[model samples]
Target: MPASLGLLRALVLLLLLLAFLDPKWPREGRVVYLLDFSPSAREGVFALAERLPREGIFLAFAERVERLPAPTARRLDLGERTDIQRAFLEALKLSPDRVVLVSDGLFPPLAPPFPLDALYVPPKPHVALSLLPPPYPLYGETVGVGVVLEAPRPAEARLRVEGPGGVWTRTLRVEGRKVLPYAFPLEGEAEVWAVAEGPWGRSEARLRLAPADRARALVLGDPALARYLEAQGFQVEEGPFRLPLEADLVAVGLGVLDLPEGAPEALRAYLHRGGGLLFTATPRGLFFGGWDRVLPEDLPLKPLGREGAALVLVLDVSGSMEGEKLSLAVAAALELIGTATPEDRVGVVVFASGHRVLFPPRPMTLQAKKEAQSLLLSLRAGGGTVLGGALREAVDLLKGVPGGRKGILVLTDGQVADDREALLALAAGAGAEVSAIALGQDADAPLLEALARRGGGRFYRAATPKELPRLFLREGQEVFRGGALEGRFPVEKAPHPLTEPFAFPPLEVLLPARAEPWAEVLLRSGERALLALGERGEGRVAALATDLSRSWRDFAGAAPFLGGLARYLAGAGRALALYAYPEGEGVRVVVLGRLEAPRLLAGGKETPLLPAGPGRFEGVARGEGVLLDGKRRIPLSLPLPGEWTPRDGEATLRAMAEATGGRLLSPEEAGRGVRRPLPLRPYLLLAALLLFLLERFLEARVPRGTLREGAPG
Candidate 1:
């Protein structure tokens, strides 16, 4: 029985050997050519198809793939939907070893059913920046054609201008992920090219430029300001009486005289005809009333009364200020006070460790003026500087003063130790402009500048005590009064409803030159929607109080939404990261397409992975701990345990998802839809089969060898 079993096993082995040795002419390697025939797919597909090897499978799909030419292996009809998964699965049926997917790399939102090795041939003749007519006219004018060169690190790119004449070359410096703008004068139909040559590769673009008709502007101001305007080549009119209707620029310096009653009507008509008016006030308060009506707010242009000017001087003295520094500050203060009118009420506050009122609100009397001088003479710098306390006290003293125009001039050499925001809030609410003069090298210029901006004032950096007076006097002329608030949207907790009410008092924003205009209503619930408000108008801007997370909430915590409702709003062409997710246990992460980053961020930390590939990343997570990006304090929690809901306080979660045009799905859905683990079962089965063959061979050959050796002995 054992011999018979051995014979049967030998027969089975012989049969397997015969099967392996028999040559039935092995089939040639099959190539499956996937041709995408979407409506937009043009000659690129046909060009790629011609490039493929002659004897291979050709599959075309617009509505379906059919009618194969000779030497083509097979044909398939994938109805309507260009489902890659369905086509891949059908290719698997044909058992093709190689696949060449020739299509515009635009994939429909569908999870691949099976793994497919695809060589994608994307469509060429790519348009980088969409060429559209400039929103503002640029016809027949030497308007600057800014060519933005975007690259990874600082790189050198050649900028070429091809117009009516020919191509002109210029060099450009490109910072990492930045668009370095190079200006070119547009004559006629022109193509601007920015070509970068580096280790990575090359990129180029050709933009069309046309002529623009130059618009005329009439500038009106005092001789000093008119000179500045004339320097900019504006037709300036220095006015005695209001200029004639033809003047495009009207600059009036009402040096203490009431503007003629007809001035407002004429100014209104001038503005209606696209004319500009720049009015500067004089010592007398004549321009205060009528200008207030024409301007958006009255306090923005008011004069710095005696009290406000006096506070500016005292703020210059403190413990940190001693010797020549203190004297210089006093001299600057005296110079500022000398400009004030007797009717102007002045108050003085001295701050060091605490606050003291040197002179309470009083009419600019001879005695008070003498006292102010005496106070300056008697001032001594000894204690630690507490600017916040001094600012609070100064604001308190100026609140009761009866004057439409008011300002606070602050002088400090150091940053405030405490309650800086509180002091800023008080100064803003006091309805008085707060300007600052930084003395010496130790002054916190940035902090002082922020303080000045919050209080609707200007900031000045004075190198020495000698410079303080001049800086203060020059900036004191332009006082920005009234409260304004600024803050960024919460990005950590997003997608969840945000319905909390936040308030920001009205503010006057000095629009930067040629700023790309955009407004966003960012809700606390992590929802931000862009709004279109027409170019340049001034009025009171308010944000309504509503719960953004509520069902019916429209303008909840959204300033832009509220601003849009009234059409009385006063207010980035940059591609930013939108979403990211982890793929499998192999430490790989995937980011949504269209976002370019210098490095990938995960779990609050940045990873050094080049984002130049097709938005997919495969690398070790670097560290043992989880990575995080953006605000770290906001933890991602799964609310309603066992259910995949975002924990409260994740302000940016919703924004991150929405910004990338993605949905904040459940963890289960994300795991199933976005991430797929590598399959180990096939490799394991192959290993098992290999081991079984070895075991069977060893059993058959070992016994036979041993038996043959023993018999010979």
Candidate 2:
């Protein structure tokens, strides 16, 4: 008992002394700080590292992680590209309390749910020129050059493009930013360069062009369609669907055809490797076929006969829209006049403080067109934006027009001071679809959107006066062409082989379009579907509302849109597309399409593929090869347009931060933490006092003999 009492006394004294001294200790766990060491991030990384917590912090560079001090003061040595998700996953494995990321905000799109601190480092003043070279250089075929510039906004830049044909240069007046597209006709195997000169400096890149291989396609229905493919330079093969041969694509027309044994397997293999298939069949033949499981039903058909249309153009001449806004409005009016067929009827209404009928509704005869053009040119801008008044006038004019199809096109800055609900009711009562355009940033976007919603028509936005005419032209074309009476399917978002490149916000089309149970919506404008895809037997099929020619012009000749559509039609089958590049000691194979099966073919031998995420596979290759899945072999080819281009990715990073409830910080404000006070001292002092009292009480209760014996051995 005596010994136990003494030990307890000593422990109490020690606790008291330690509590008074109050020594500081490091926090519970270390913080991991990840740094991006890409070429653009080097200079800023050193400065960023100094801002991190001084103690219990580990440093990690791209692809490699190690303890601090060992990695200190080293050059920003890392890979050319950065994989943020991979690095983050590695950091998570370390089990740190928090992870800090220092980068220039150029990360690929990441899904939701993660905890991270993103410290943005503004890139040094520099311009980067990224080019999209054509996948194949076909002689006499024109290919587009896509250029993206990353530099300080509002700076002058000169783009000089040189190819085999000659040199082309243009001085571009860039807004905060711009995407410049150009076209060049291919001649032969040649070296091409796209050089950009700006305030930051000069940046140039070289690309080598080679001739394209002639792709083979089989047409199984209309002989005319086969002839059309031949005209487009495809090596055409025509026969029944049972033709025993290999081809890159297949097109079918309306008819009942017999399927051959193993043909379905062959087609399924083709679609899996990113081949395309198209069908132009009658509605009856499309639904009631042997392809029930794969083919889409309830497909919309074009109208049997063309119908005339009546269109009313409502223009806003408000005082706020004086200079360029008025000019663009007049130009749009003229374009609408140009689109009117001889049988179409047109009218015009102009409104500022009040609305006036510039031209009453009438058949678009040669004389009527001349008078409407004259009235539009004579108009001038003034007063407030009375949108309701103008819409009422247009509805009145269109009420009695003779046609099943009728529409009202309103072009304005969208600023208004009128009864909003009344205007919408007028549009709905007239039974004419009302489509609206917001001319500039200051326009009342919400009101215009609501107007179009109630009227059951499309809504469009023009960021600048220059874009106004195009929007008007598209609107005019729709009205003059009879308002999509031949219904088109608007795209709804779904995962498919065709939607890989569609990253923009969903766009909505006015007309209501739908898909069958087997079909999936791939693209949308807002809420409306724009494109849909499905399968037929082993082949893929697609439907589009927008005319291909008009879409090309509107999208600045986007080749991928057409190519992706074709690939969807071809259907994704069981195969892999491998492109090998020499890396360090071995070769790296990139899975081009969604790698359905993991296998490769080289010199007629098959090998299993080891997956490295983001469509990469590491392998040892004896020579060039192709990707394979069972009997299907997808040949190695040049990268697609979707692969060659790099996205800026600023929006993606912001979204990730927002989704995780984290804050974004700049370099000046990164890595600093406010320490909370530790209250261990008071708790320690109180515990020691209690233990001393307990020892004293126990010693007092012990007998004298028992104390002498003390914990008997």
lDDT of 2: 0.60
For every candidate, C-alpha RMSD to the true structure in Å:
24.4, 26.3
* lDDT: worst 10-residue window of model 2: 284-293
lDDT of candidate 2 over 29-53, digit per residue (tens): 4556777676556566666666666
Q: CA lDDT of each candidate?
A: 0.45, 0.60
lDDT of 1 by residue, 509-583 (tens): 111111012322332222221111122122121111121222122323333322122212110011112222222
TM-score of 2: 0.34
lDDT of 2 at 193: 82
Model 2 CA lDDT for position 219: 69
lDDT of 1 at 307: 26
Candidate 1 ranges beyond 4 A from true positions: 1-316, 479-713
User: What clash count goes with each model?
Assistant: 44, 21
